[model samples]
Target: MFIDVVPNRGSPPAVLLRESYRDENGRTQKRTLANLSKLPGDVIEMLKALLNGGALIGTAPKDLAIERSLPHGHVAAVLGTIRKISLDRLILSTAKDAASRRFCDLVVAMMVDRLITPRSKLGFVRAVDEETAATSLGNLLRLGKVKDHEPYEALDWLLERQERIENGLARRHLKDGILVLYDVSSSYFEGHCCPLAQFGHSRDHRSDRLQIVYGLLCTRDGLPIAIEVFEGNAADPTTLKSQVDKLKARFGIKRVVLIGDRGMITSARIRDDLKTSSLDWITCLRAPQIQALAQGDGPLQLSLFDERDLAEISSPDFPGERLIMCRNRDLAMERARKREALLKATERELARVQANVRRKGSTLRSAAEIGLAVGEVVNAKKVAKHFALDIRDGHFSWSRKIEQIAAEAKLDGIYVIRTSVPKGELSAQNAVQAYKDLSRVERAFRSLKTVDLEIRPIRHWNANRVRAHVFLCMLAYHVEWHLRQRLAPLLFHDTELDRGRAARISPVASTEPSASARSKKAIKRNANGDPVHSFAGLIDHLGTMTRNIMRMPQAKKHPFTLLSKSTPLQDQAFKLLDLDPMRVQ
Candidate 1:
């Protein structure tokens, strides 16, 4: 709102009022009051001096609120706790500039939501319109503030934060030893120029792109502790032992039971890594590969397996194997039915082939050959074939095909679990249970891919930003994981992921960033009596309240008190972090 005291055509300025006050020397002083609140305080103060208007400003608290109106309420939920870890702030604020703080606040906003990156962060921070944002972003880029490659640096920041949390956790909960679940997977990037991208075994049908190896070490409760990036062409088996070694070296964890999928690590490497290293491991092996071990009656007994998920064992120096009983009667029947169906399919194909041959005036020549080819499609046009039937194509009967399928299916489904733990240290049944516990890693991966930090296409090109980007994503995951560990049971027992993360975030916002936007327009009359208006938009910033904030800290001039002026966003952040919601209310 503007005052009507000033008329058109800036011929002369209208005086608002007059006042007298005692000077610092206790002398009486006369002053002319002017309406300078419409402009920024700094600008108004400067204008008063240029025109010799003796401090035409409201120094009194009651009169200073010239711009007050509605309440711009904000809520800060979780940023309070995150601040205690000061090292993290230093890393993200690497540049120590306008851009760095802006990026950091935006990232903190994500951490508030629990994580984002070039591709991921780009999805958020969308402005009022695409063009406006794009222009602002382009300017930011020119200023070296916001770039496409920022997320990768964020990834590094993520790892660093993980270390902090790990150290913090050990300092707090020593009894609940950390459960480390390990796993390996590959992600392919479709770019020839990508140095780390290469073609290797892909879990997804993405052989066309260069595939990179990734190994994750997650907690039993599904929180990621470490994630390593490898060259695209690297093999999983070769890296497993080294990662295990790295885990020990970095965290100095000796009491960890490394649970892993059978395919993640080789048996030979397991022995090489864990035999001397103070660690216990549980892994499942392919039964058919170890068929001799399965069929033997001396070492391990299958029938002795007390329960379905339970197993019994008795082996040697390293440990023993568990023969889990197949108690799933329904699964057993399904397996049998599946075998029967295969047999039928084979037999039908063989019969169709024989019929086609007979119609074409071809003879089986003999019963032995015909029997061998039965249930197999010898001729391509006779019937669709699923597998090889001992006999050649175009001459089998439906029965032989069915027999072959049934034979194959009969030997297909079974499970064998292996352990390197000693009999005294860990029982066979315990080993089996331990392997089940290993599934914690998979759950952690699920949260990484879905629940919290869904960092996929990793759009950052500059390595540091990319690292920083993924780092925050990881940090968010860590925060939520801890939140759930500490608060899930307390607040929600049956909540699925969608509801959990939504409710777990610390509801918070900082008010300083929006200060410029909250200002009224500054107007000035031109020589022709035309009014010119100017206003600045949002400028992001961040600050934290200190424990010794009770004492007023003096700036270069006099003692300053920020007590009355509240940074509303900071208030919300404190509330979200489960800290005090207000600053000394």
Candidate 2:
């Protein structure tokens, strides 16, 4: 039996308690049991209580009741996906002892929290205590109450097994003949105590702050395979050999084409270290090398870009290697614009310095001072090569180096890539595509530093702890990569068509009224023509599903917990991730 509300034309809606019965004709029929509106309020309350298995009760004082809610749905969704990926089992297999296994679970919990809500170690502990939904993680792991220091302890343990863990991941996701992308990025440190934190090239642009360098290795599809940490003072070129050794010796990968930026591994290292090991590599040439190829009467000339945007050539500089040159018209325009802006700004500053030197009745009469002022303006722009300036007899003269500017303009938007991999193994276009895939590593670094996992502002002063901190961030990214792939329908992911070509679902808008307008227009939609959400927005939508613990005033001894039902959108998201909303509890 159920209570039903019926509408009327001009009177109060009728409320009837009805029961369904099967007639002898095998047809279902509903019979009116009672007019619920005609019953007294107390009798209606009793009926509701009876219908709810006696769990519902008459109202009591609302002021004395306490209610608490925690973020459950998003965390559960992430945890469920983690379990489906067998991450827990993989971590458990790495453990040699019971304590290590428990620590592994703690690490897994930390990763899940990192995905849902990134927090510091102390903040994580507080979240675990305050959010009852987080305690559900403990239930999933079948562990007792977690101590405050266990997360840090787990980090320490995880550091010891870093090699084994990364090796396991590489074996699972990586294979030979794959184009492996490599890139290095630095995360700044808050303190100077960490041994790994040294003053070097700061990729974060925090030159005043010390930092440690870390290299991320990933497959062609941008799935991160392993991460290596080096001293803060390490140079980019110097870090490549160690990574190549790691890929060959530690990860046991063979016949893989390593791809990196021009600054990462130099031509010298490629000719020596890589050649000695019989390994293949693909990387771009530095500006000087490109200039050398274009300036001289070599096979690669400025006329090459005039006919076509891409061409393959041979160079004496890199014998027996294919040089694939690419020219992007958009890049040319952008570079020209930036160069002109810098030149105009530099001219303005130079004019100010010239006026200061030539001012009448000025005390700045020394030639040394005038020379210093001229040197400052010239060196500040770093465009001294494109300008001719001189100071003489309290007067200054400056002119743009027209010939030099024209020479640079010819090479604009042109870059050369050197690869040892045969054209049959990988064509020039595919080689260019492979090098372009380096953006994936850049994206991974962006996600690590600023987006998903905030792997910066080193909080741990101990070197091992610092390593573990970064390692934890890498592990979180591992999960993030999978999440992005599985949730691609709702995200702006590259889709591969039937013709074996990749296409971006959301193409760059050619024009927009404003930046905000472009952002608003960037939203993607699913096949249903409904607007899809970004990864963050999708997580927030899932977070709306909550777990509630209710305590009735009449039933003081019984407090029951129930997971809130998912809305249609939330259910759809769960379906995309292959997670059952009912199993979230």
Top candidate (lDDT):
2
Query: All candidates' TM-scores?
Result: 0.55, 0.84
Q: What's the distance in Å from true for residue 56, model 2?
A: 6.2
Give candidate 2 regions above 4 Å deviation: 1-68, 94-96, 130-144, 494-527, 551-560
Where's the lowest-lDDT run of ten residues in candidate 2?
504-513
Candidate 1, residues 342-424: lDDT per residue as tens digits?
A: 55665666566567556665666455656545523434233344445444434433323566445334334345566555567
**lDDT of candidates 1 onward, in order:** 0.47, 0.78
Candidate 1 Cα misplacement greater than 4 A, ranges:
1-118, 121-178, 276-278, 296-302, 305-309, 316-414, 423-430, 450-452, 460-472, 485-585
Q: How close is candidate 2 to the true structure, as a TM-score?
A: 0.84
User: Deviation in angstroms for 183 in model 1?
Assistant: 0.8
> Residue by residue across 433-535, what tens digits does model 2's lDDT show?
7887788899999889987778888878899999888988888888888888887656545333212333322111111133322333465565555567777
> What's the alpha carbon RMSD for model 2?
6.9
